[model samples]
Target: MMEIVSSTVEIVIGLLVLIGALFSAFSAFGLLRLPDVYLRAHAATKSTTLGVLCVLSGAFFFFWYFDNYISARLLLGILFVFITAPIAGHLNGRAAYRTDVPLWEQSVQDELEPLLKGKKMKYEEKDMME
Candidate 1:
C-alpha cells in the first residue's frame, strides 16, 4: 500500500511539472506572436507570471511532500511574484503609453486619448496666444 501511494505521488508531481512547463512555453509563444508592445507586455507579465507560479507551486509541493521539508525561500518567492507581477506590468504599460509607443491598428479605443489630448490642447493654446 505504501509503494502504491508513493507511485501515485510521483505521477502527480510529474504532471504538475509538465503542466507548468507547457504554460511557460505558451507564454513564450505569445510574447513572440503578439502584435505590439502592450500585447507583448501582457503576455510576458500575465502568462509568464502564471507559468512561473505554477512551476514554483510544483516545486514547493515536491520539496515539502517528498523531502519532508517546507522551504521558506520557495514560499517567499511565490508570495513575492504574486504581489509584484501585476504592479510591474501596470507600470510598464503606463510607461509605454507615456513614451508614445504605437498601439496596434485594430485597437479600437484608448481611454488615455482624451486626457492626453487635453494636455496637448493646453500647450497648443498657450503657444498660439504667444
Candidate 2:
C-alpha cells in the first residue's frame, strides 16, 4: 500500500513538472513570435507564472513525500512569483506605452489612447505654460 501511494505521488509529480515545462516552452515561443511588447508581456507573465507554479508545486510535493519535509523557501518563492509576475508585466507594458513604444503594425486598436489622451494633453499644456 505504501509503495503504491509513493508511486502514485511520483507519477503526479512527474505530470506536474512536465506540464510546467510545456507551459514555459510555450511562453518562450510567444516571446519570440509575438508581434509586440504588450502581447509578449502577456505571454511571458501569464504562462511563465503558471509554469513556475506548477514546477514549484511538483518540487514541494516531491520533497514532502520523499524527505518528509516542508520547504518554506519553495512556498515563499511560489507566492512571490505569483504576486510579482503579472504586476511586472503590466508595469513594463505601461512604461513602454508611456515612452511611445509603437504597437504592432497590425494592431487593430489602442484602448488606452483615448483614456490617456486627456492626461497627455494636460501635461502638454502644463509644459507649454512652463
Candidate 3:
C-alpha cells in the first residue's frame, strides 16, 4: 500500500514537472522566435506564469504529502501569484507600449499612442540624466 501511494505521488509530481518544463521551454522559444516585443511579452508572461505555478504546486504537493508539513505554503504561493503575476505582466506590457514597440497589425485601438505622443524623448532624457 505504501509503495502504491509513493508511486502515485511520484507520477503526479513527474507530470507536473514535465508540464512546467514544457511551458518554460515554449516561453524561451517564443522569446527567440517572436517578431516583436509585445508578442514576446505576451508569450513570456503567460507561459512563464503557468510554468512557475505548476512548479510551485508540485513543490507544495511534495512538501505537504511526503513530509506531512502542515504549513500550507502552496496556498500562500497561489495567492501571491494570483495577486502579483498579472500586475507584473501588465507593467511589462505597459513598458513595451510606452517604448513605442510596434504591435502586430491586427492589434486594435492602441490607447497608449496619444498618451506617449511627443513625451517619450523628454522622459528618455530625464532617465538618461538620472
Q: Compute each candidate's TM-score over C-alphas.
A: 0.84, 0.96, 0.72
Candidate 1: C-alpha RMSD after superposition:
2.6
Kindly indicate the candidate among 1 and 3 with the higher lDDT: 1
The segments of candidate 3 whose C-alpha lies over 4 angstroms from its true place after superposition are 71-75, 104-130
Task: State the lDDT at 10 in candidate 3.
Answer: 88
Least well predicted 10-residue stretch by lDDT in candidate 1: 11-20
Best by lDDT: 2
- Ten-residue region with minimum lDDT total, candidate 2: 1-10
Ranking by TM-score: 2, 1, 3
Clashes of 3: 0
lDDT at position 47, candidate 1 = 80
Which residue segments of model 1 deviate by more than 4 Å? 119-130
As for TM-score, the candidate ahead, 2 or 3, is 2
- Clash count for each candidate, listed in order shown: 0, 0, 0
For model 2, what is the alpha-carbon lDDT of residue 54?
98
Which residue ranges in model 2 land beyond 4 Å of their true spot? none
Cα lDDT for residue 4, candidate 1: 96
lDDT of 2 by residue, 1-130 (tens): 9999989999999999999999999999999999999999999999999999999999999999999999999999999999999999999999999999999999999999999999999999999999
Residue 87, candidate 1: how far off, in angstroms?
Answer: 1.4
TM-score, prediction 3: 0.72
